[model samples]
Target: MAVSAEDFDHRCEPCLVIDQQIEAHGFCVDCQEYLCKNCFSYHQRIKATKHHHLVNKDNMAKHAVIKESDECTEKCQVHKKEVIKFFCPKHEALGCKDCIVLDHRACDIDYIPDKCTGIGDSAEFREVLRELDQKVNEVEDIIKLAACRENELDSCHDRLIKEITMFRKEINDRLDQLQKQIQTDVDRKKFTDKQAVKNVVETCTNISSDIKQRQSRLQDYKASQQNGQLYIILKQAKSKLKSEEIKEADRSLEKTNMQYTFEQNQDLEDMLSRQNAFGKLALSSSL
Candidate 1:
């Protein structure tokens, strides 16, 4: 069938180009469609950009519906809930399982259990933060340096370009004025005059060629130096800081749950039993 823009538009709603419906599933989590792709607006970005309306197949088991895996460390603090990871209070460093095992072999070790773990006692957390701060500062430093370099390079480039332009203009002017004078010569001194003009042209041409080369080099250098390399380095620094943020949050955490002393059930069984007896007596007495 010959297709046109008309096939894609209808009424106030966007038209469905295809009529096929998902008979099995009522929705597509990806497509967000009761029908086919043609029937749905391609909602590309959402808060959860990955979520889509998808229809379930007829034979799909309700019990077999898969839930998204919790890929993030939501509840567990010691990344993957490994065990009693220890941090050296003296050195203020992170200790992996192997590190803790080897280092605490003889010395007094302070193991931070996953439970009852606190930032107050977490040197590793503090260390990671310190490391992040250091990296961010380093990036900031490089950016500052790059900015200074860019300014200096740009100034040098501009001066060279200006010099080349001035030289090129002077050479062109001399060549043009000399050529015009020769062309307009009226006297019979043509032979001598032509030779003199030729020499002058050669000299000016050589100077112009040299200036062109200098201009090209200066342009190349300026372009390389002008792209805000300093700014990009600043961005890289921020990106590194964010990465460390993820690293710091990775496995070290202490989540505290407030506990109340109404924590246990008192002896309410007798009271409940009496209430139940009273209700039964009322029912019987009414009858």
Candidate 2:
């Protein structure tokens, strides 16, 4: 655990430790040695130490803390610096003054990123988006793969159905001849034949049910894809609206518009009449 200055205070040289009067800065840069302004040299020269270094100045304190500087969380692949707090009004990222001087000259620097990102840039929000987008993409890709599966099922089922129909027709013609040869009083032992017919009907029904289920899932997958797109837009909108300062800033931001107008309702009528327009569907009995 890191001890406070008070906990370590006067433990060494009492005279070396300065109060607020001298403006005490913490720790050294070149060396990890801790000292107030006065005792640093004496602390350095004590043993095998020939040259002692110290950090007392404001600039030195700032430099020493670089390793201790809190990591920046905001990501803009274009910018290397962590988004500290200040957002560049004209640019697309949050940055510091050093960034402002170089790349963000046209931007209005707002509050530090640390203070404003409590809700939007939190770990929970990031994790949620990452998981949601990943799952949505994965499901959509599976649905596309299912198209090939559906085609295979259709081809396999059609061939088997044709074969079944031909076999049944031959079996029925043989049964008719067998019945004519038998005596009228004969109690035909047809338990096996009845069972075979029942089995065939069941097999066909089961396959038809499988096809229906796949069709339903394909429809649901498409619906989910559409919903996923809208959900993404809504999430972005919610995040934008959540930050008060961002919303306020954007309200006044100038927007450039490009406009074109249609002459009549002809386009709307054409869309309504077109069978495939906007994914309108008409299904056949075979389907």
Best by lDDT: 2
| Candidate 2 residue-wise lDDT, 115-213, digit = tens | 343547688789999999999999999999899779977997797678778877886798678666553323232444445456555655665675566
Taking all chains together, the TM-score of candidate 2 against the true structure is: 0.23
Model 2 accuracy (lDDT, Cα): 0.53
> Per-residue CA lDDT of candidate 1, range 1-287, in tens?
86553563221111211222132222344422233243333433445533554443442233233323311223324334433345566666555444545554444445443222355557867898999999999999999988998997799779767877887798679868966775565333444555555655565566567556555655665667754654555455455445543333222221112222322223444654575532331222311
Best of the candidates, TM-score: 1
Q: How close is candidate 1 to the true structure, as a TM-score?
A: 0.26
Candidate 1 residues lying further than 4 Å off, grouped into runs, are 1-116, 184-287
Candidate 2 weakest ten by summed lDDT: 12-21
Off by over 4 Å in 2: 1-61, 64-146, 183-287
